[model samples]
Target: MELRVEGLACRRGEAVVLRDVGFVLAPGEALILRGPNGAGKTTMLRALAGLTPPVAGTISAPQEAMAYGAHADGLKAQLTVAENLTFWAAAFGTSGIGPAVAAFDLGALLDRRTADLSAGQKRRASLARMVLTGRPIWLLDEPTVSLDAANVARFAAAVSTHLEAGGSALIATHIDLGLAETRVLDVTQFAARAAARREADPFAEAIE
Candidate 1:
């Protein structure tokens, strides 16, 4: 699978958050989107996932791509860990939840409600849902936000395995995810470009 973005730009009303960003990611390859706060890293990820429309340019992604946003959006706080997996598997038309549960080390927490799980546990459960999607491309935004060192290592291992299996990933994070042969794109450049555009017009507000 491959993902290609050409001159991708996103705007919120009159403010341009991202502009003229381009990249191509082939199967088994990964790219890390790095920048300081408000650099449009999260916006780019959302654009790749088709959750937010790009103000300009185009994104070409495989039909099977899946995106895991910064928040653990897929988890149902009312459901048990096992139930959540089961629901995700059904939604994705997968056979079962065995693999996902085992992959993320959720076996022991199967009976626990999602609300009762720790932040790391919730992140793991969210990752398990992504695995169950069986998509070849993953767009992850700050995937390791609340993980401790041990769980961070575990997340890295899971990502390594995904890449080894012919998957591709686009991650937006400040922390290292430990992916091998990963490319890095500094989104701050795009932000700077946006800033330059505003300098010519003193009345224009610079996008953060």
Candidate 2:
């Protein structure tokens, strides 16, 4: 399986942050999206995940085959760790939460409510849900947020295992996740200057 993006463009509200971006992610491969802050890394990830529609071009991948993890750890605050994993298990059409539980080291925190867990614990729980999704393509935004060095190593191992299983990952992060064999997409060239142009001349559109 593969994800192909051609002439992709992304907009946040009235501002266009990305334009004419293109990339291909092949099976058993990983792509790291690198850019300075506000350079549209998150926007690109969201567009690839089908959460936000591209203003131009195409993402040639079935929506169901992609699993997305955003900056926010999307957990039900009141639900216990195990319950959260279980909910995602059924939602993503996958069974058996044991592997997911062990994947993120959630054994001890399983019975605890998400609201009661620390930042790292909650982040792990959120990531464990992705394992349950069983999707081939993982679109992660700042996936290593709040994780300690040891936990980061665990995440790297999980990603390695997924790749070995013929899965692909597209991660947008500031810190290195220790993925040695990965492609890098620097989005600086794709940054849309239209937003700044519009700011300089509000009436520029009508005159042109």
Candidate 3:
């Protein structure tokens, strides 16, 4: 499978966050998006995943084959860890959460309620849901939010497995995910130009 983006532009509300961004990802490849807090890394990932529309340009890919994992865990506080994962697996038309459970070290927390898990545990559960989808293209935003060093290694291993199985990923994060041969896309260039343009024209915001 191949995912291609050409001159992609992303926006949040009326504010354009990024522009003229483009890239191509083939099967078994991973692309890491690096940028400042407001550099629009999340917006880029959202657009790529079809969670948000691209303000400009085009992305060519099978939208149905993509899965998005946002910063939020998207878990139900009252549901057990296993229950949440099972629900996601079914929703995504996949079965058997064993792989995700083992990948994220969720065995011990499987029977526990989501609300009872620590921040790091909850993050792990959230990330595991992405794997449960069994989709080829993963769009992850800040995937390692609350994970520790060891858990981060586990997540990296999971990503490696996915790539090895002919899948691809577009991960937006500030930290290193430890994936080999992963190319980095710095979003600051596009965002900085947008910021500069806005600053140069004091009334740009008002006009928009």
Candidate 4:
């Protein structure tokens, strides 16, 4: 699916963080969001993922076409890795976990409870949810957070393969993932200023 955003705006708790943000993500492409901490990169992704309703402008994408990943490593601590993948697959109306397991090298850890996994292992499992979703667009916030150098390479490779297969991704990260379909967007330019707010209806209202 193609993701199109225009004059988009987002907020974090009562403060407008980003405004006049716009970008298009076509099939097989990736956009890297960059800025200092708290610069609204995550906010942009949230709006794009439909978690945070946009404060302004428009976002056009298919319903349920985007999969979101945050720093939290969303997982069922009591469930085994395999069980977790199965649950997500079913939730997304997808029927298989083979690809995800192979993509994340989770074969050996499948039967282990998620709580017992190492941080990197849990991170991989969290990201593997993207595969289970079968969504065309991925919105990932610091996806490589707990990964080691090797796992980072693994993730980069998986993303490369995803793009090759016509998927799109929007990622916020400080380090390079070495992907060829990458484009970098700095969110600092779109920071919503108090002056702009006063001039434009106090543009954003927070979600949390």
Which 10-residue window of candidate 3 scores lowest in summed lDDT?
Answer: 190-199
> Could you tell me every candidate's TM-score relative to the true structure?
0.89, 0.91, 0.90, 0.92
Per-residue CA lDDT of candidate 4, range 1-208, in tens? Answer: 8899898989899888888888889899999999999999998988888888888988899658889999898899999999999999999999899999999999999999999999999999998999888889999999999899999998998888889999999999999988997899999878888438545665443321
lDDT of 3 by residue, 7-49 (tens): 8888887888888887898899999988878888888888888
Backbone clash pairs for candidate 4 read none
List the candidate 4 regions with Cα displacement exceeding 4 Å.
Answer: 194-208
**TM-score of model 1 relative to the true fold?**
0.89
Residue 113 CA displacement from its true place in model 2, Å: 0.6
Which residue ranges in model 1 land beyond 4 Å of their true spot? Answer: 62-64, 192-208
Tens-place lDDT per residue, model 2, 1-208, is: 8999998889887878898888899999999999998899998888888788889989888989999999899899999998888989999888789988888898999999999999999999999888899999999998999999999888888888889899999998877877756998998868778544656897876797
Off by over 4 Å in 2: 194-208
Worst 10 residues of 4 by lDDT: 199-208
**Per-candidate local distance difference test:** 0.81, 0.88, 0.89, 0.90
In TM-score terms, candidate 4 sits at 0.92
Candidate 4: give its CA RMSD in angstroms: 5.1
lDDT of 1 by residue, 1-208 (tens): 8888898887655677887788899889989999888778888787777777788887787445765555655788999999998988988898999878877788999999999989889988888887788888888888888888887888788778889999988888788777897999998777746556665775666543
Clashes of each: 0, 0, 0, 0
